[model samples]
Target: MAEMIVLKGLIKRFGDLLAVDDISLDVKRGEVLGFLGPNGAGKSTTMKMIAGFLTPTAGTATVCGHEVTEQPVEVKKRIGYLPEGAPTYGDMTPATFLDFIAEIRGFTGTERTKRVDAVVETVDIKEVLCQRIETLSKGFKRRVGLAQSMLHDPEVLILDEPTDGLDPNQKHHVRNLIRDMAANKAIIISTHILEEVEAVCSRAVVIGHGRLLADGTAEDLMARLPYHNAVAVRVTQDNLSIVQEGLSALGPVEAVAEAGGLTRLRVAADDGKARLADVAGLIQDKGLAVREVFVERGRMDDAFRDITKGETMESLHQGDGNA
Candidate 1:
């Protein structure tokens, strides 16, 4: 697939703070790339720069071979942007707002009318097309914003928090719409919702503290973090220490926590393989009646917490040492 958007060492500063620090990315045609980060993690700043809404202090960005700063007008024409808040004219109805946007994009006559009607139908805003924007619900307002963005059928779509404030049905509809549209255009979806990545994106890019942390498929990112296949065992007695000792004899137990009359043991082997059977055998040999046993899969939230916390601790240690 062709590269629709490219950034090299992209940097942006606000006074003494570096909002985006030396980030680089390439978005390909017909791909939906999920942009993820914690709050204030520079995800929005990076999106703004890519959409030609903010100028970078250093480095460069290009959209369809045109420099963002040098040819913003041309770049804007090739991209459809839905900002974070989905701002719109409160006085104009959906149809009128879409018409105004179509005119700004240089559409006229039947072409403008056709495009507007098509998007209104695509986004399912036809029910409230004539209603005043201020009177519409949040979900309907979001649909209006989406209609305007898709009005020109731009090759690149930049959607920031597209499903914010949407009901479950509307969210599902928008997710499906994005998936259907991804076949013909490159999309960069900036959202904190991890489930959205799994639902609609082909790949994901995770950023932290104004820097890129991980970029790959969701499974790839999950594999990079440490995860132990754990076994939750419930014993007849509440002596977790005894169970912990017995489990340790079988293998190197990474962690043992007791909760709800059960000892959850995370065992680690030299090869880091699943040792559930070994764990069960150890419990049986110890004469402990296993009331229940189950394998627990590692969660993405655990990986995210470990990575971000480790980075934060390292930064704090460095600062303390310097002081």
Candidate 2:
């Protein structure tokens, strides 16, 4: 796949504070990269630089072979960007707003009309087309913003919280639209919603404290979690200790706790190769009555919290040591 977006040692500063700290990454065509971070973690700042909305304090960003600072117009022409909050003209209707965007993009006459109509249909904003932007619900307003960004049908899409304020069905529709467009475009979506990354992104990038933390496929990131290859063993109280010892004897058992009115024993493997057969065999060997047994799947929410929390704690510890 062709590299559509590239960042080299990207840095952004606000007064003395470094909002983005020497970050570098590549987004390729046919890939939907999820830019993830806690609030104020430089996700928006980096996207702004890439979209040519903010100039970098140091380093550079390029979209579609055009440097952002040097070729802002060219970069803008090839990228569709939905900024945070999806800001729009409160006085203009959705149709008029999209028409204005189409005109700004240099489309005119039948071409401009066609583009505006197509995006309005694609984003499903027809219901609210004539409503004032400020009068529309948050979801409808967001769709209007989306329609504007997609009006040009650019090769790259930079969306910050694209599905914010959207209902479940709307969110699903937007995710599907992103997937459909992923075949030919390089897309970057910044969102705090972990489920969105799992559902739509081909790769996930995590940042915190203005620094890159981790980058990989959703499943790849989840595999870094401690829960990876962990299995939950539930048994009767009479067999709690017996099951714990039985599973522990097989390898290493992580923890034993109470959950869902049963004793839950969590067993883990260093390599994610823990087998259910071995665990069931141990139960049979020990003559223990197993109430329920299942392998724990890695969860995005758990992985996101753990990664960000651990990084924050580690950074604080380092700061204290320096002090």
Instruction: List the candidates' TM-scores in order.
Output: 0.81, 0.91
Clashes of 1: 0
TM-score of candidate 2 against the unseen true structure: 0.91
Reference-based lDDT, residue 125, model 2: 84
lDDT of 1 by residue, 1-323 (tens): 39998999999999999889899888888899988878888988998998999999999989999999999999999999998889999999998999999999999999999999899889998888898999999999988888878889999999998999999999999999999999889999988777788789998877777877666766655544345355556654456567777877765655444666555556653344557788878877887655676665456666566555555334323423211
**Residue-level error in angstroms, candidate 1, position 80:** 0.7
Question: Pick by lDDT: which candidate is best?
Answer: 2
lDDT for model 2, please: 0.87
Name the candidate that leads on TM-score: 2
Instruction: Give the Cα error of residue 265 in candidate 1, in Å.
Output: 4.1
Q: Report backbone clashes per prediction.
A: 0, 0
Cα deviation at 36, candidate 2, in Å, is 1.2
